[model samples]
Target: MQRRIIIAGGGTGGHIFPAIAIANALKKIDPETEILFVGARGKMEMEKVPQAGYKIEGLEIAGFNRSNMFKNLLLPFKLLKSLGQARRIINEFKPQAVVGVGGYASFPILRKAQGKGIPTLIQEQNSFAGKANMVLGKKAKKICTGYDGMEKFFPADKIVVTGNPVRGNITQSSVTREEAAQHFGLQRGKTTVFAVGGSLGAKAINEALHPLLASFVEKDIQLIWQTGKPYFETAKTAAAAYASHVKVFEFINLMDFAYKAADVVISRAGALAIAELCVVKKPVIFVPYPFAAEDHQTFNAQSLVNKKAAILIKNDDAAAQLGTTLFSLVQNKALMEQLEENIGKLGNTNADMVIAKQVMALIG
Candidate 1:
């Protein structure tokens, strides 16, 4: 009998990318394995998972809204509805195991799977567990984590320190810096900095980089900026005067190329982003999103800083210090090399495969 797996999650690329990586790993181990995805109705996973050539069913669910207490009034009803929907999906799919990568949508699916006595696996990308994952961890047969000390979150015996899974193109690309620069139509021999604010874009990061636009071009510094959808038009207009030295986009789907072209990186410290940077081996300035669940982004970056791996600038001070910090990195070869080598030591290139194999063994 062919084995079937259910991958559930994705409100951001951090969760979506790792989920896809795990799915690809499962298929590699057993080519005949059947895979399905479960996601929130309007989240990016609906499009992204299907694009990865997997079937994903949507649940009518939403996470708690800290911004509006009144908006959370319907939380109980939605949770109940999603639980019913997940039961139907799991029953129809008849999955051998369900793998959750940490999103609001994943909670109900994994919860119902546990109730049904189906094996459940979890991938906790963040060093700190989200509330939902914390609850889910109680029953997860195997919990794969990017960082150590996760036994504090899940069962000690069930934990696997497999690190976070990154994309194939990011880990195995043969594109050179020069080639990537040409692909982005950027000039050769200029110091290039890559700035990405994640899937929705960071308003503060965008504001910080916006003022440094002309200075970047003036100092022969090229920037590969992913402004994300919300701010692309505004950022594009802002950079029009120095358009030649900058490449601004709503998204960079070809991140492998972008990573190659970068001399230094300025990014929000998402877990998957940190994992990719470790593999790319670049000098990076991390601006941790202060509002992340449990402030996990800061914890993620702090782990690297503790090892003397990378530099961090607080989110509030990014506007004042981001440009200067990146400029210093570009000019200081020793500092750049030190960061690259130290952070690269933390890379786990085969985490997805290790995680998938563990999940399979648990079910078997």
Candidate 2:
């Protein structure tokens, strides 16, 4: 019988990328293996998964509405509807194993798999284990994590310290400094700062960057700013005067190349973003999003700071302190080198391969 796997969940890059990484790894081990992706109907994975050359099915699912409780009054109904949908999907797919990447769709799919006595796996990307994953891990065959100390929530014997799988192009990119500078339309001789608000974008980060554009250029720093869709027009107007040294974009499709061009990076501390940063081994200043679930992003950045691998600037202090903080980082070559070295030590370029190998062991 052909080995079939169900890959479920994804609402963000942190979840989607790892799911894709595992899929690719599994295929490399057994080209004839069967795989299917299940994601929230309107989420990004529906588009991205197919583009990566995989089949996908959508489940009408939504997570809890933290901003508006009234919107979630119908959540119990949605949950019931999704579980019924997931059962039908699983019955047809007949997967031997199911992997959950921890999004809204994951719980129903994995819970169904567990009920059927099929093996289930979870890849938790955050420092704080999500409630859904915590519940799933209680009976999961394996729990792969990016950080340590997760035994408190998971079965220690079943846990594996498989660092988050970063995209290969980013983790193994070979673009040289000059090549990446050209890719960003930046001058070859200037120090470049990379700024990104992540996929959905951070409003506070965009606002903070607007007022600091002139001073940033005055210090001879070039910027690669990802202004996100909402702030593109506003951020473009703000950076119009400093176009010579600043490249403001609504979104950056070629991030590996951008990483190569950056002397310093300023970003929101999303799990996948942090994983990719560690791979590139750049000197970075992380500004964690304040409203994140349980403030997990801050915990992600603090780990790096504690290890002298990166600097953490609170979201509130971004405007008042980011410019000076970056200026100090750029001038101090020793600190920059130290951060690169310390962070480079944490890069797990082979994580996808290792986890893939383990997945094969389960099938055998």
Candidate 3:
């Protein structure tokens, strides 16, 4: 029989990348496997998934707005519409198994699949599970997770610790520091710091790093900044004066090279970000996004900090203290090495493969 699968989710890189990784792994195992992606309309996955060489269908869906009650008034209609769309997609696709990587679109597809008596899997990419996954857990046959001790969040029997899947290129990258520096047009000898706040950008990190650009230039430090879309223009204007030492981007297409070029990294402690950082084995200072559900970013970062694998800076203190703290990190060679070694120990490079195998097995 032909094996057909449906992978659903995506609003951010944290979800999209892992879904792609798992899809790629599934393909590698059986090149003839038919995989279809279901995502929310207007989400990044619509573009990103196809670019990664897979077919994706978008449903008319949007997540709840906690701050705006008016926006949520239309949510019930959207949810009903999306559930109808999901059922049609599942019926037409006739997938042997459905995998949900947590996102707004995931719930409807997984819920419908479970209702139809199809095998289902939910990949929870956070230390704390998202509400969508929590709700879907009752009917899901398996739950793949990036962290341990998640019995409180889901049925312990259903949980499988597969870790989060990072892009294959980054995990297997052979690009040297000098080669990566040349890729970014940065000088080889200078201390390079890569600061990122994920794909959408972090306002606090951009603001904190903006005032310190001149200080970095004065000290002959090299910088790679991913300012995200909203802050790009302003960040570009500030970086214009020191173009030689600074490279500012709205989004980084070549993350493999970016990870290779860094001596130190400052980033948000998103689950996917933490997984990639572990693979890159770089010294890191994480600023957990405080507004995240259950303050999960802090929990994600704390897991590493407890193990002395990374340093954590609170969001409130980030703008005031990040510059000075990063300066100290860059100067401490011993601490940098310690962090790199310890974090590297946590990297699970074969998570995509593990997830694919388990999903196949559970369905069989």
Candidate 3 stretches greater than 4 Å from native: none
At residue 183, give the lDDT of candidate 2.
Answer: 86
TM per prediction: 0.97, 0.98, 0.97
Q: lDDT winner between 1 and 3, please give it.
A: 3
Error of 3 at 294 (Å): 2.8
Model 1 C-alpha lDDT per residue in residues 1-364, reported as the tens digit of each score: 7998899888888999999999999999999999999999999999999999999999999988878899899999999999999999999999989999988889999999999999999899998889898898898888888999887778899888999999998899999888999989999988889999888889889989998998887888899999988899999999889888988999988899999998899888999999999998888899999999899999999999999899999999998998888887888899999999999999888998999899889768
Model 2 C-alpha lDDT versus the unseen true structure: 0.89
The best-first sequence of candidates by lDDT reads 3, 1, 2
lDDT of 3 at 210: 91
User: What would the per-residue lDDT of candidate 2 be over residues 1-364, giving only the tens digit for each residue?
Assistant: 6899998999887788888988999998899989999999999999999999999999989998889999998999999999999999999999989989888899999999999998988888888888999899988998888888888879999989998998877877788888989988999989899999898777877887888888777899899999889999998888899999889999888899989899889999988998899899999999999887778899999988989999998998887888788889999999999999999998888788777877777777
- Poorly placed runs, candidate 2 (over 4 Å): none
Best TM-score goes to which candidate? 2
Q: Supply candidate 2's per-residue lDDT for 338.
A: 99
Residue 193 lDDT in model 3?
95
